[model samples]
Target: MTTLAPASAKPTPSAPTAPTLEWVNKLVSFDTTSRNSNRPMIQAMADELAARGLSPVVLPNPEGTKANLFATIPARDGSVTGGIMLAGHTDVVPVDGQDWASEPFSPEIREGKLYGRGTTDMKAFSGAVLGVLPEFLSRPLLEPLHLAWTYDEEVGCHGAVALVRELDAWGIRPRLCFVGEPTSMRAVSAHKSSQLYRVTVSGLAAHSSMTPAGVNAIEYAARSIAFIRSLADDYRISGPFDESFVVPYTTANVGVVSGGAAVNTVAEKCEFEFEFRTIPCDDPKSFISRIEDQIAILRAEMQLENAAADICMTPLGAVPGLSPQGTRAALELAQALTGNDAEETVVYATEAGIFQRAGIDAVVCGPGSMEQGHTANEYIELTQIAACEEFLHNLAVHLSTTERNEQR
Candidate 1:
């Protein structure tokens, strides 16, 4: 976790006007993982916004561990009627255990592609937004433009919650939002929601020879895991979604599990983490409730033999799913800007759901392939960047058209 000091000055006149490539390089240099503080990156972005004459508000977590940066470029009319929000996360996933060809923090360009830890999983989009700031500012925007960069999106959609709260506190609601997640420049209208849970089972431990005298926590955990798997099967069968997504339905799986000490002694404690990605029509809490009911029955059976037997379940995190609400204006605008007639839905989750739930229409569209994200030697193709730049250019034109139409 290296923290670079924020630059005090604006980009030099000779510097490239577009912020894309250069900003991506700088952002990749910082290791802003969810576990590590993203303050430095937030500070750097705030400085950049300040240089553009826009004052950014830094909303930090209660502990000041991470922060969200928000800035608004007000319309010339001084009316706060409606605006468009550009949202991206500052934090990236951990690369600690992942193997890499080059330094994870250091970015490299090969075969007309940029390779780094956050090259696609979202820092690239953030860079793209910053890179186009000059263009955005140059235009006489009829409506405000809101820039929102949040943290801790990798671990769970936690940081965006703080940002949403801040927006509520300020009473600043945008009419539309774009979450620039990696979509290969296609417009994504819907995505699944993620619900994570940790289950803990506790039992009495004794010598293996005294099996009847001690309750086996691991065995109980195994039973509970089996039930969870069964529920996953049900989700797979009953869940509804568009067939465009890879899985085409809800999915659940166990991610991590830990328990036991010695081979000779009965295991005393067992804990496991599981997650489910559900369609918008599915209730995230239903999965937890079903599991809890099963666990209650299991606990009762265990308690009959040993009063010390216990089981606990807790929600680790939750990100609501975004469904296509009728026809999304943002999606239509994105498609028009990109000159694409077809649109698709993704199985991967993004902050779009949060924005949409807050009454802001949202769509996911950006450069880079999702396959490259979180992989060794991750990269976004140069062509993708070109397409994104064109898209932005077209978006500016569309805004101009809208303003002209309104004037008429």
Candidate 2:
């Protein structure tokens, strides 16, 4: 069974004040899965920020079912210069199909580990930032520190895009950003981008005996899928050649395919969802265009047999890759704060790329391991929270020292 943290319980400072862990526990208690609404959690966070005397800007989606929160602690001298942004997502992946030893929504601590959905895949990082608010507030800041938490990250990098646009509209640009994704306390300077495409094939349905008289949508879909597989093979051979990533190259896969109603009937429709994780240097559009070109050729051939035969491709979402920025100063600061140097890259996508694209030198660095993210019994070690507290402490100290220097 899932163990939910008591929402009303005040955190004890003597209990090591793992603010991030406490925050993560509170976040996990809410069922903020990608398919469900995350407004409640966002509102809670906004209230928390307000209570800390920070004014939070809530950017809500058109439907008002979700939101992204952005807040800034201004420099003491009232300078309008760019500052550092700490980013994290408010939404988590679904736990519907996963088996678990405890309720995924209820956070539980066992043997120095906290287990719950979103514990590592990043509520912990957001919580950590919130947990350290007291210290951050107490400091005299030289440069502003911005906090940005977005929704719908699991669906795509959607919420952050909106938040970034809002910031742009307001003419608020940050110098650097730290995306607190699960990096096991290391700094990640790069990650592959994800581009998703959904292809739909429409054809005339007919009896199996008259299959030749009707175009088979399923067969056409199979041809497209085969071409995609061949493309994947070519990319595997060509290689992105990065030693940091596990695959070391762009990878494409068709994840879902659906069509047909009966065994004796000629299928009239087929749809498949495919995605490619492209290296930073690779153009995702080039691969997508290849698939489109192949589909066009196939459609032309099918049209010769049946004028109604058609194939269409629609883009679901595309997240840009994070290119390596030489010797990131933000990363160096994070390392000094955390006292760990285990830097690396990852195959999974995150909003880090978006921040980098917005011209904010960005790095992914935070607590916990990706291995536990989005899995059954998802967890973060208690020690990771302790380390994060120390990191935030160092950050606070750095802010104070920098403020002192600026005063002189």
Candidate 3:
């Protein structure tokens, strides 16, 4: 991992302006929510980079609806090896049901805070990176600087799988990566793993009058839900605990469930979505396996009631947890950039885990607070944005050959 000196002085007149709320405002206007296509926003940023003599690689998803962008500021020697990566996701969560004081997509400034959908959850960091692109390009750095933008992070980190695969295939391993997830400009060293699953129950349908002839899908679904709650209780009382997190133990919950079409007729189908968060020492797949065992039991019982009864569990998404035990260099670098003496852990998951799993030492350090993300009228403080600009400046200086030389 690379270590940066204190941030340098403000840029010269020839350099681009420091990243500001104006850039974030433009990004929020695009409405690149995970449920919709993000190509428009991707193209817009790609075009901006293209105009500046930098070529960005666009890796589209299988449907061509979304994409990930990877671009590099070549080293002074024109080598693309061993640099730092500044990464973020382009998509944000939807604003369908949240109550908002104003339009969620339209960025607004109130009392020095920029209010918008992705302001804090993170287009602010992206904006800060964009603000300094010209200056980064103008300098002759010792190592390359890469900007990596992925999509569908709000949808269980789906886009990052392909993005990391592409980066790994590129054969030019970066020394480290900085994931700009909101940490109020503080460095985050760890977060819990997140896993989601959808369970579907199928059963025989019949009139309410003929009770035995029909299988009540909802009834069995409730049984499964009860078992899930028991698992949660077990974790709560168990010995596995990491004092760093707000919730030190693992947690499970069924977020969405649906079944019966009518009140009278016997339900023929039921479906429920559930998720779990696990500490770094715990394997999420272990919980999934237990749930599968419970599913088998229900399947057996349902089969006795109705031969046609069946149950299926499908994985929705998963993002690995990041642990700080082996990340001393990355942690030190993050602490230096943020000027925070103590490292912290967060409950909310970020792309840092994915990068860390892929063998890139990653740390989360960006502007704003997680409290503002994924909420109506989300915002980032102007001061936080200013701090990110300073961090970027230090990053630029850190990547320059003028710093003490040490092979990565």
Off by over 4 Å in 3: 1-4, 7-19
Per residue, candidate 1 scores C-alpha lDDT tens digits across 1-408 of 211122113222322225677898899899987889999989998999999988899988989989999998777676454677889988888777777888988998777777898888888778877888887788777788889999888878888888888888889998778888999878899899988889999998999999898888999999999999999888677766557677877788998999998999999999999988987677777878888899999999899989989988888888888888754778876776676756788888899998888888899998788899878788777667666666666655555443243210
**Deviation from native of the Cα of residue 230 in model 3, angstroms:** 0.7
TM-score of each: 0.92, 0.93, 0.95
lDDT of 2 by residue, 1-408 (tens): 211111112232323375566787898898988888889999999999999898998898999999999999988886545877889998888888899999998899988888999888888888888888888889887788899999888878899899989999989998778898988777888899998889999988999999888888899999999999999999999765677788898999999999987888888999999999998778888888898899999999889879989999998888898878653766666665565656678999999898888878788888889899988889988777766666666677776663233211
**Candidate 3 lDDT score at position 193:** 92
Candidate 3 lDDT for residue 75: 93
Report backbone clashes per prediction: 1, 2, 0
Given candidate 2, what's the lDDT at residue 198?
95
Candidate number with greatest TM-score: 3
Per-residue lDDT of 1-408 in model 3, one digit per residue for the tens?
Answer: 344565445532322243455677788899998999999988888987898898899999999999999898899999898888999999999898899998998888788788899999899999888887777887889889889999999988988889989988988677788999999878889999999899999988889999799999998999999999999999999938999899999999899999998888899999999999998888887888999999999999999997889988999999899888774667777776666667899987889899888888888988889999999889988888888887887777777748654546
Q: Which of the predicted structures, 2 or 3, would earn the higher TM-score when compared with the native?
A: 3
Query: TM-score-based ranking, best first?
Result: 3, 2, 1
Model 1 residue runs over 4 Å out of place are 1-18, 238-241, 402-408
